[model samples]
Target: MSVPATPMERSVPRDARTSTARMLMICAWLSLAIVVVLSLSIGATGITLAALPDAIQHWLAGSDDDATAARHSLVLLEIRLPRTLLGLFVGAALAVAGAMMQGLFRNPLADPGLIGVSSGAALAAVATIALGNEFAAPWIGTFGPYALPISAFFGGVITTWMLVAVAGRHGQLMIGTLLLAGIAIGALAGAMSGLIAYVSDDRELRDLTLWTLGSLSGASWPKVIAVTPFAILIAFAIPRLIRGLNGFLLGEAEAFHLGINVEATKKFVVVTTAACVGAAVAVAGVIGFIGIVVPHFVRLIAGPDHRIVLPASALVGGTLMVFADILARMLVRPAELPIGIVMAAIGAPVFLHLVLKRGIGGVE
Candidate 1:
């Protein structure tokens, strides 16, 4: 259970001052735009930022006569653009999903990963990699290139549904019950994934290992399309859930007393989070820290206003992911490091500092 904030804290307008929120929003937008441009312009190929307009023009105008322009266009259009877009969508999805989960649970640490979604997705992906020729043959045959992503998406959805079922009492969903059930389910899913990994051949092991570590190296236009709808779903949800999430900070009973449809809010959050995290995991593998770290960081900057935190988290998260992807490409030169590793290296110390300095008193 979350510790309730004091009366003085609750009395703050919108749970954040307007000036701070506005400034954060401005900074977030600028940061995102800058990082996105950099992500497209910088890579192992040494593409200069100034040349992007020409490259884009060449690509759009279908001019292959200039070999230099053609190469730049190919790199920009086919590779970096899709990869950058994937980072944006995946990052935004995870961050907003994290913010929503934290608000719903009234816990500062809450994220999609807390509820077994990532674990379930990882388990399914690993299983597909390890057992596709055997147990998953039919689905693999049908899905072909799409089999792993499909498995991951459904795996997350199924796990959340099971969590909901186990945590429901009478007609109401208990936050405490849901949290406990999620932890148990997440642990179980992790164990199952480990078991599958244990029995896999060397080739299967390599594939699953890399998949779990996470990357945008496999990013393409299809993946960008696949994850975009879920990102839009999360965007649409933020406005509707803002009031409920704010009221939730006062506790479920208080939210109910405030005329918020607590049950409906809970269900919507669960469904949206499942889809968002599922699509993100399906495309980028299990990139961690963005969900937990981005929202918390946003709250620190913008205050606890869901109005500020949600959208700001989306911007900051997307910025961070694109920046991280750039680092992943450049840090090891031609051989890329897993983006997940880069995220952990960047996020862990920051999270530890926040916890130590602020104490975990549940998002006040």
Candidate 2:
């Protein structure tokens, strides 16, 4: 007879894990810096690198009175700043949510959008619009600014909770079952959204349709401010989940044996995912595949550890969205294409390649 190893003995390999963690941190920081610089530099109105900092300073100081200074400030602060920051926050939030969903389900292809959260949020938003109450309610209209994002966030939370309750049992999420349930829920939401669209006036219908396609063109300071708190809160919460996510890789029973509270971890993962994805959808509509694409690429470079994977996904996701936004702005020049279309255009082919190269089950 042989004695079982102690919990500490069965833990992740320390030396290799530490090395991987360091590499991921380096890559994440570098990528984040590059994206920020690139986002600030490029836009519809040209702003040279040398003048960028001055524009930012003038905007911050509320002293941009000169024509050149005012134009640059408008470009940086009003247009590029909100859009880029929203993209950064939305991208980071979606990627982290995707990372958590993958870890929770132990399925590499899992994404919050695919699981009906985005659709759910979109449905709710479209419903609000159809009701002619996009900003008419006293509390929301009084605030005047935060109404859309606030409504969208609540829509995401409610839909995600419904999905979880419908799909889960005693805190256990069965991957195949969950996917099927998500498909069903998404279809239902999509159908209802269509029904709402059919009965609505042309203008409302068009607005709702455009909203579903996703665009950062609507980016504004208020939306950026609205998404910031939830995004930061969720992103901050993700690091604390590193250990539990790592535990998930070793199988549920093994994780439980290692002192992980599996049920609580699952619940936390679900709530965090909903919160993050909901905020993104509220702000950006349904920009797809950032969640699915970014985490896999991060794992390919940084390995499968959640600690590294989560942060690296955020960095990579932000960069990808910023670039995609650039392309969206430029692709139709003077007429913006939806960011969702741009992401799907890029993401679909790459996703197919990853699927073929790794096979469905092989991605993990």
lDDT of 2 by residue, 255-311 (tens): 899999887887788788888888898888888889988898777656788878887
Give residue 258's lDDT in candidate 2 (0 to 100): 91
Give the Cα lDDT of each candidate: 0.89, 0.81
Report the Cα lDDT for candidate 1.
0.89
Using Cα atoms with residue i matched to residue i, what is each candidate's TM-score against the true structure? 0.93, 0.86
Model 2 score (lDDT): 0.81
- Taking the tens digit of each residue's C-alpha lDDT, what string does model 1 give over 260-332? 9999999999999999998899998999999999999888776788988888988999999999999999999
Candidate 2 matches the true fold with a TM-score of: 0.86
Return the top candidate by TM-score. Answer: 1
